[model samples]
Target chain A: MSEKHLQTGDELPAFGGKLRLFAMRFCPYAERSILVLNAKKIPYDHVFINLDQKPEWIFTFSPKGTVPALEYEQGKGIFDSNIINYYLDEKYPEVPLQPTDPLRKAQDKMLVEQLTGAQSAYYTAAFSSPSLTPSMVETYHKGLEVLQKELEVRKTKFLHGDEPGLVDYTIWPFLERFQALPLLGKQEFAIDKSKYDVLTKYIEEMKNVPAVKSYCLAPETHAKYIESRAKGNPDYNMLDTSAVCCMRPRKKKE
Target chain B: MSEKHLQTGDELPAFGGKLRLFAMRFCPYAERSILVLNAKKIPYDHVFINLDQKPEWIFTFSPKGTVPALEYEQGKGIFDSNIINYYLDEKYPEVPLQPTDPLRKAQDKMLVEQLTGAQSAYYTAAFSSPSLTPSMVETYHKGLEVLQKELEVRKTKFLHGDEPGLVDYTIWPFLERFQALPLLGKQEFAIDKSKYDVLTKYIEEMKNVPAVKSYCLAPETHAKYIESRAKGNPDYNMLDTSAVCCMRPRKKKE
Candidate 1:
């Protein structure tokens, strides 16, 4: 068996020392978890996972074989980025990530689901395609349009109204990545910044935040990562649009 | 618009001032929220939603357009059964549905995701088909095999461990429905109880629980529901699977 295919057993790393976040730096889901940790000022270890060849330990703990798994002390491993954020909120009740209002909390979670489920597909289709197909572009635009409308309705400084909360932390990473992808000769899908004034302003505001800004990759670097994948480099563990994009745009017959 | 499609916007009848849970009796996701209410013994008005004609409020609040949704006193609606359950657990912390141990909590959430993402697909394909196809039956059995193996390894009374927790509540309702559909002759997917002794015992134990048993359709009634759907009744929302059986099996096709 390839060394890359080895499995990581379900054991938590020693804790009260440092919590390990197994993540891919460019993955929005992973980024969301990091944003929560940073926002809460929690100190921990960050293990940047190679998505192409996921460590066996990761698969052992997360049977779904996904990244952004958390290893807390006492040999407990938590999978799913959103659940991990919730864990942090519960474990560290101070500076809660979710809202106190039950209804608002529900909305926050629904919006996160939308980002992951609906909008993701559009971004994925655009990024994975060898050349930007018209269908892929349209899908990306539709996703952005939906996001733009939702942001308009919220009319908040961030996704969850006023201060950045779980919703904002969860979505911004993807939105930023979507915008960054255009530098790789992927045509900039018109976002109509004026249509989503709140989102545009929120993006600017998020960039100013020390933690978000610190982790934010320069556009050129991100494009380089995409370029490497397009070149079919075997060692490419970089962000492949296929991994991140959830929406699969219908392919047209050649 | 049909009267059934319109929302009165009026408050639904409440039990102890808690809003009603309008859901299909057999939906596992719906059961998750209901389990929370049952575990807490929280009084709630139970309004069974007809899957054939979903209420407009349900579609408006639930973006995915599935159940179970909750209507609060202030016209605030919560959608997505899992998110709604989280709202309930957080707002009514007196009887917590989630485990306090971070590791156990993570495992609980992961198990719930697996049930929804992996296992549920089999039930969806099998039960949703107009006629049970061999391929659908194969898919259903494959899902059951994975579930059986997982149960064997854990050997817990509930999905998480000894006591029933969130994952058990989330999955049990769906499994109940999946098992019942075959008895109706709508499908003929086999699940050998002997192969999964723990799961067999678990299902029996679940059946005896007053809350679970009370909500479950009498075997005769559930059989009727399945038969009605098979007859192409417009009122039946379950998928017809008759065409599936005519198709070749997966291994042969490959």
Candidate 2:
């Protein structure tokens, strides 16, 4: 429940005897696993870590100290957002997030792959605005177009049919963050209603999805984080208000 | 069965009513799929394409005109080597390349993810020698260490188990090509037996894998291809010996 990001030399939190996820607060890749956990309604503890000043112990969970590593067992861990999400889908199985059909699963993975270019463009427009080229802008729109076209073809409430599945969850984080570009003065990156009517509708619908609604941050907040990160001093603890916790509940004796 | 790569203006070959894969002769990514297909004993047709001057029809199969695109059902296609291979493993369930266990599958994927750094270093050392850095070299060795460490822990004949699985098939193409680095004058990239005893033994065993032995090219051959590719004019048709028809048998009347 704590939003605070632990940094270097930070003590490893005592194992609470539950599934634990090591992640950064604002990373989209990390957000992906968070959304999956919420969707699966799985009980898990979250340990937010500062990516810039990563805690030494983070490497124990992820070889490269990357976020979104799942402490599945007491000391064992699994890294990578897709790997974690897929494992969750298979391991839990009660609330399957992927299609039963293998071909459809593969197709879902391909659609996710198609969005890579758009993700690159979004990163450029967000943190390296000056280096944002015309081609990248084109790629940004191409990503939207691909989503829109797929939406038209599937004709489903969500890309995953009646409910958003792995493809939708995997991609929704990027869509969530892309909305912040225009807020950050990158008007060219906007997903206009005129050009992306289907995609825009889908975005609005995704915002209401229970899994996404809880963990999703507002575009303005994302823009602020982007600004800080772009300035070379990321406010990793922006959401940690323990210092000013006037309404904080007193801790019970353990 | 032509080793020839089809270029622009080349006619699309008859589909033969069998599964077909679009690929380049020397592309490692393409080779990954080829190995999987061979391992699974799946009946599929291979179409080698000139990557630099790709045939127009390639896009019909893969939007980016990239190789290892599978024409799964006549004209319908699936791109990305991983996607295609996973689909193959699932579609043709007779020979499952991936483990059924979700955790083990996740671990296999993570290992592949860890190899990305080494792959980048290999690319630089092979094609852009001037840009190769000390850190890149270190990263490459780190990749080897990761594999060796996994082998030590798993204590399996192959990364996949007694029989080589998806993990082995996916990583073997890179190991095969890594041998070419030393032959190309990048001696530092060698997988020294003294340092990588387990990996060296594993490499030899992988070379003997029926799926790999039938399709694997020698280090000298890969070095020749790398040389041609680095010079900016890839010899896409170097393996096409149709022009020298002295030993060719005359076609029978169809």
Candidate 3:
């Protein structure tokens, strides 16, 4: 529960007997795994690390020092959001996040792949405003249009189905954070009701999804973090849960 | 069946009632799908296309015009090697390339992801000789070391156990193509028998894999293609399967 980022030379945290996830407070990729874990209703501990000054030990969990990495056992972990999410779905099949149909599953993965360009577009718009161009905005809208078209074709409440599944959890994080763009004065990134009626409606419904609502950050929070990160200093410890939780990293009793 | 490169104005091939895969003759990513389909023993037709001058129809399959797109139906197709391979495994479960254990499957995916850095290094060394740096060579070896270590730890003949599975099929293409590096005068990219004894032995075993042996090309062939590709013109039709009976692309009877 501690948002205290372990930096270079920091010791690996003691094994707490629970599955652990290493994440950055504001990374959309990391948010993906968290959403899946929450939806699966699994008991796990999360450690938010400062990506700018990554802990040397983080590499033990994530080979590239990127997250979200899942420490499934003592001293053993696997990284990548899709990999972790798939593992969680397969290892704990109670909720079944992935589609049973083989073709549907493949299509789900493709949709996620298709959205990468839009993610790049968003990053440029939010962090490097000057580099933001008409084409980038076009790419961003193309991403939204792809999502809207998929939703229309699927005819489901969520892209997953009547209930949100892997596809839903995988994409929700970006959509959740895209809302922050408008807050950061990037109004072009806004999900307007008129043009994206169905998508905006879907977004409204996702905002209330129990799993999403529980740990979801406000758009304003994401905007603030974006500002900090753009300034070459990330506010990793913005959520200081030390005062309220037993899960906080505390000094050892001598 | 002809290894002919389709260009901008070529007509779309008629639906042949068999699953069709769009691929470049020398593209490693395309080879992943080809190997998987062969391993699965699925009767699929492959359409070799000139990636540089892609047939207009290729875009119908892959939005960005990449190879290894699978047309599962008459006109519908799904792109991305991983996506297509996963679909093949799940849809044709006769010989499952993917492991049933979720953890092992996730680990398999992670291994592929980890090797990507080395892949980039190989690309630069093979295609842009001047940009090749000592660090790129280090990355290339690090990938080999990572594989060798995994082989040792697994104590398995192949990454997928007794039989070559998806993991082997996925990574084999790159290892196959890596052989071309030494042939292309990039001797630094060679997998020496001394330093990479296990990997070399494993590579030897993979070369003999039934599915791989049928389509696997010699290092000389790969090197020749690399030479052409690096010069801005890929020898897409170097295979010249046109003379082979019943394999050449011919006009359908009107």
Candidate 4:
């Protein structure tokens, strides 16, 4: 894992002999693909970049310079969270995350699209935009209600039946971030446990899924990152571990 | 083909033995799927509904009362143009519009996403939106330039190949609708013959594709629809031919 924020003038990182993902520490979109990668147990290298001042090479991987771009080969890549995740699931089909039925697969994608309403509302709330309307808050609740209904109808431990699948991973990142809304002073955005009982339980279960558990962050951490980004100076290195040493100081011929 | 606008309290159209698609007369999104069905020579029926006054049963087919919902079974469906197209391409593999190569498939979807900039701009211009900005025009051109660049690099008669594929059909509708912009007084939206020689040629070829040729309307017709829609009264059933006789009023067939 490399947590370096390579800027416009920085050199491209040396290619590692594994699938590589260009990501930012705090992007929910990036986490969607990450969860899929972990769920499939695919061996890969994670390259974290600063979104605000992205390196030129990032565009080579992602045309829009967006995160969650996968460099499957030294110079070959693909971007877009859903596209990348679908590619990953198909290419590494040893553990398929998508449902086998075509209708089920379409429904999974629809669920992801439906959840984006709340995600958009979260974005507005996090960015502290003054234009965040009441309807936006309503949209947030409607999104949650849709998920709860789906949970009840599917009658599964996770949206993906016994375990989390593509649908679960695709929407989990947004749900994971939605928890930080109350901390951001957007109380209306918080999930009311009493109302969303099924969804609430599902969230708890997702946090325990090995794939998500391995990489998910707490609401406080997300809130802090949101605060910094809202102030126009995103703290992209909030989770950097590259600075840590091997517990031994450098010594000559030690 | 039924170009009738069934409103609330209207009966759901009886299931036709074959697959059915709920569409609107002038919707580009709906046309996307229609073209796919035609290109594949799939047996299906089309139900043209009035979007503004959607039938109560429309939700049974499409959750959001949106057009282009595919009624694959008696009471089951999958919404979203892309989702419907993917389902059709998968279920009816007799003619595969999608590339077998995963990377190429991803790129095809990405190109659709990329062209959305121009589509949004066209929407704004067609609606005569006050919010239309110079940046919107810039975005429209940027989208065109991107397509031009891709066409030049791919060196293919069509985006898919000599034969039009999913990418071509997916994008052709928007390109078809875009021609209506110049007629709507948005001259900036015009595809200058000299500036976009390649794209212009591609557009002409797509219009001639048998699948597209059968259903696509003239630019003047599209411009008229845009004008009516801009006036807040969309002439949805402008081309209604449901009342027309099979030929000479059945010529006293009885």
- What CA RMSD would you report for each candidate? 11.5, 1.6, 2.6, 3.0
Q: What's model 3's lDDT at A252?
A: 62
- List, in order, the clash count of every candidate structure: 25, 0, 0, 0
Instruction: Report the TM-score of candidate 4, chain A only.
Output: 0.95
Indicate the docking level reached by candidate 4: medium
Q: Of 1 and 2, which scores higher on DockQ?
A: 2
DockQ order, best first, reads: 2, 3, 4, 1
Which candidate leads the pack in TM-score?
A: 2
**Which regions of candidate 1 fall more than 4 Å away from where they truly are?**
A1-17, A73-76, A93-95, A128-156, A159-163, A181-188, A227-254, B1-18, B46-57, B124-163, B181-189, B218-254
Per-residue CA lDDT of model 4 for B91-125, tens digit only, reads: 88899888877788888878888888889999998
Better of 1 and 3 by lDDT: 3
TM of each candidate vs. truth: 0.74, 0.98, 0.95, 0.92
Worst 10 residues of 4 chain B by lDDT: B245-254
lDDT of each: 0.64, 0.93, 0.90, 0.88
lDDT of 3 by residue, A1-254 (tens): 66778777776778899899999878888889999999999999988787877888888888889999999998899999999999999999999998999999999998988888889998998789889999989999999999999999999999989999999999988898889999988999999899999999999999999999987899999999889888888888777766556875667633
lDDT of 2 by residue, B91-186 (tens): 999988899999999999999999999999999998898999999999999999999999999999999999999999999999999999999889
Displacement of the residue B91 alpha carbon in candidate 2, Å: 0.5
For candidate 2, what is the lDDT? Answer: 0.93
Once superposed on the true structure, which residue ranges of model 3 sit more than 4 Å away at CA?
A: A241-254, B241-254
Error of 4 at A186 (Å): 3.2
Instruction: Report the lDDT of model 3 for residue B124.
Output: 94
